[model samples]
Target: MNQDFVNNLYDIKGKVAIVTGATGALGKAAAWGFAYAGAKVMLTARTQSKLEALYDEMKAQGLECAYQIGDPIIESDVDHVVAATVKEFGGVDILLCAAGMNNPKPILEQPTEEWEAIMDANIKGTWLYCKKVGQVLKEQARGGKVILVSSTRGKLGMKNYTAYSPSKAAIDLMAKSLACEWGEYGINVNAIGPTVFRSDLTEWMFTDDTARTKFLTRIPIGRLGEPEDYVGVCNFLASSASNFITGTTIYVDGGYLAG
Candidate 1:
């Protein structure tokens, strides 16, 4: 095949992407990655201030992006986000569920409320958005992409991660189930699993602490993951390049799971 033909497979210009948790580290990276790649991005988050700030920042960079304030776990809020995206961008071609939370604590010390919160945010929120967007995609019948964020925790057990790990595990399975269910419509559902990426949640690991050193040894690459490391994978999954791929978790860790 010609090289330009191969390159054009990744093109996503004019595609409309709805990104939840648009203010978070990985979410921000994904949103900017899509916007800069010529796709129009609609960002959704709970806080208007943070969402507006991110929107302004992207606007300054001449990126095409908009914001919608909605709590990911709320069903009605999710409905509104889908409706808003249709109104703003005319239609949706991609959905990125990036809103998630983690509360690391020993099993006994993990409060019921904390576990519920993590489940609600990471699992329920992702499912709700996927459900609504899946409807839209099916109706359009043009095939689309659904990208869910997972983590290595989904596959690997860790201390003080009882609640968080299970939540991510559910996300991974959800992606597979959705992929299989939507394959007939040409919708691709996949998850991106990252190992200890730089984010507000992982700020503690970035400091001069022993945990950082211990974690570093587990990763064969010998360093932590930065948000920028995610741009390529996001672009690939959100574009035609990933048309044949679905029902999989593409791990973007620095070879952490390899070892």
Candidate 2:
């Protein structure tokens, strides 16, 4: 094969991507990554202010991207966002489900409300979006890509991370099931299992000396993950580069899981 042909495998130019948690740090990073890769992007989040800010920045950079307020767990909200994307960007060729939450507390200390919140945002939210978008992709019959955000907690048992861990674990399995079910339609589904990263939720781990050191000890890289760490994986999954890959979780953890 020619070298340019191989390089073009990773190209996502003109693709359309919908990022569910576009306002949050992780989602924002993924949105920018896709936009910068020459794809038109549609962003959704419960908060509109930050989403608008990101849209402005991307617009100023001459990238095609738009934002709308949406609650990923709401059925109507999912449908509305999908319609909005097709209306504004033509059609959805890729989806990055980054909308999620975590409430760190011991199992006994975790309230029923907190458990529900975690499950709703991390599991139900992702599922709702996947289901709606899956419908569109199936109808289009053009095939597509879906990348769900999971975390290291999904694979490990840790203190104060009970609700979060289980929710993420669910996301990974859901992605797998979707991958198998959607394979005939050419839709590739995968999950990104991130380790401790520097987002608002992870500020404590990076700022507190003791906590930082503790996490660093577990990571062979002796450092924490930054939001940018997700960009490459986001681009790869959204592009043709990973067309044959599906139903697996890629841990971008600086070797934290290995150690």
Candidate 3:
């Protein structure tokens, strides 16, 4: 292609990124990566302390960042985050929906409330954020990038991940459908399906010897994933490098799905 396109493909300087679930390990890693890439980042989560601490750390590193504390599952909170981002940074160039919950239960034993909770946080929350923030991108006439954090469970059937898997599966399809509808406006929608990673949510799995061994045995790569392992891919999908790419889910599973 053009030399200019190649040169600027991954250049995200001056862009504004909004990362939900900033309090979580994966989310924080994404936020920091964007900030380090010279993008002004807006962090969002339900915990004020964590958000503030992360924002402070980024600022200390001389990275441009701000934060808002709120629950992603709440519509008003989503609206406030978008509005605040617009007010402070003009508009958002990228959106990273990383807020999600997982409750492992066999299909037959899964509680109705737990199932609803997973769907609400993972599926509906993602849709709502895309709907509201996507409008701003469309109106501004600047194509934007949206990356939804899904899981390998979405691509493969897992035994006890009934609730979590389906919600993530919906997210993968949702990204595709949104890409189809929004492509004309220059908006790209994609997802990242990650395998086991060291995070607060998965600490319990690591603590159990049998569970850890079982999980590692499934990965052909012979190792588990870390949050940093996904940073590069997240950056690519959010930057100009992925301008022509959309409606797909990129697996960062380290061969977990291969076997």
Question: Cα RMSD (Å) per model?
Answer: 1.0, 1.0, 1.4
Clashes of each: 0, 0, 0
Q: Which digits, one per residue and each the tens of the lDDT, describe model 3 over residues 105-202?
A: 88899889989999999998899899999999999998999999999989888789888888999999999999999999999999999998889877
Reference-based TM-score, model 1: 0.97
Question: In candidate 2, what residue range of length 10 has the lowest lDDT sum?
Answer: 198-207
Model 1: clashing residue pairs?
Answer: none
Model 2 lDDT per residue over 171-194, tens place: 889989999999999999999999
User: All models: lDDT?
Assistant: 0.94, 0.91, 0.91
Q: Against the hidden true structure, what lDDT does model 3 obtain?
A: 0.91
Model 2: lDDT equals 0.91
Which of 1 and 2 is ahead in lDDT? 1
Which stretches in model 3 have alpha-carbon errors above 4 Å? 1-4, 207-209
Q: By TM-score, how accurate is candidate 3?
A: 0.96
